[model samples]
Target: MFWLLFTLFMVACFSAGATGGLFPPGAWYRGLNKPVWTPPDWVFPVTWITLYICMSVAGARVALAEGNGIAMAFWSIQIALNALWTPVFFGLQKIRLGLAVIGALWVAVLLGMIALWEVDTLAGMLFAPYLLWVTIAAALNASVWKLNPEQAA
Candidate 1:
């Protein structure tokens, strides 16, 4: 049972990370005016992959622990929200909605982190990078929205 849950969670995390690339490729993001601190495009995949691995392991740890249903549910909710972000921002080109989704995602991540902390501190800490990344993404999304208010669909 633990292995099954772990595998499922890992698959889900990988799928969520892949959603970021759903956008039409090549310069699709480059043309947009980004914040000065936006890291190079290559940095994103590396960061996201690392974060996803951490999230998967954290989730698996929680699943293997005792009485972690609530934490698991919270993690699932946040991940679902995380998955929606790429589609909203890239697939549908809804920057404002994407910002809103990511904002909610941040809160969900915080809740998941807290829940994980109660069960296992390391699990919670594993989620930290994901939380930080999402927070930064939220800020960037807001900046994009502000800079391209007219561009929002």
Candidate 2:
């Protein structure tokens, strides 16, 4: 049951992550003036893979536990927001909207972490890296928006 739930959660994470393929960061993103801190292209997929595994473990732990309504809901929220950002930013080419979405994602991750921690310590521990990644992502998104004010519409 735990493995099944973990697989399900990983599927959800991958589903959300699929947006990257759907909307690859092509010429537009390449042309943008990114901060020096921007990670090399290779880092993204690797980072996401690690984060997803941790997230799946966290979610699986929470799901199998009884009375996990709030944690589950937060988990759901973070995933939804995660799925939304790529389409809005890379698909629609809305930098400002991406910032908003990523901002919300950060909050959802934080709240989700806290909520998950209340239920299980290991689950919360698993989520910690996700929050940190989102923080970095949010900063990156913000920096992009700042550097490319012309693209904010």
Candidate 3:
């Protein structure tokens, strides 16, 4: 049962991740003016893969907990937002809209982490890195939008 739940969560996370492949950051993103603090391109795949595994583990753990409705809901929200951002920013080149999506994602991740913590300590701990990564991603999205006001408009 635990393995099945984990697999289901993994599927969800990876499905969200697939959006990146579908809407890869090509020439447009490379041409954008990014902050000096922007992570190297290689860091993205590595970090996301790690985060996905952790998220899957967290979700699976929380799913089996006594009271996880809110946490699960938040998890679902975050993943959907996660899937939306790549297409908005990379595919449609809507940097401003991407920022909005990521901003909402940040809130959902934070609330989900807290909710998960209430149910299971390890599950919550698993989300810590995900929250941190999302913080960086949101800041990066905002920074990109600010630096490229022309594109943002």
- Candidate 2 lDDT over residue span 1-153, tens digit each: 999999999999999999999999999999999999999999999999999999999999999998899999999999999999999999999998899999999999999999999999999999999999999999999999999988875
Tens-place lDDT digits, model 1, residues 1-153: 766777788899878877866664346556777889887778888998788788888998898899898899999999899888888888888889988999999999999999998998999999998899998999999988877767775
Better of 2 and 3 by lDDT: 2
Q: How well is each residue in 54-104 modelled by candidate 3, as lDDT tens digits?
A: 999999999999889999999999999999989999999999899889989
Worst 10 residues of 3 by lDDT: 95-104
Of 1 and 2, the candidate ranking higher by TM-score:
2
Candidate 1 deviant stretches above 4 angstroms: 1-4, 24-28
lDDT of each: 0.86, 0.95, 0.93
Q: What TM-score would each prediction reach against the true structure?
A: 0.92, 0.98, 0.98
* Top candidate, metric lDDT: 2
- Between prediction 1 and prediction 3, the one with superior lDDT is 3
RMSD in angstroms between candidate 3 and the native structure over all alpha carbons: 0.7
Better of 1 and 3 by TM-score: 3
Q: If ranked by lDDT, best first, what sequence of candidates would result?
A: 2, 3, 1
Which prediction has the highest TM-score against the true structure?
2
Name the 10 consecutive residues with the lowest summed lDDT in model 2: 144-153
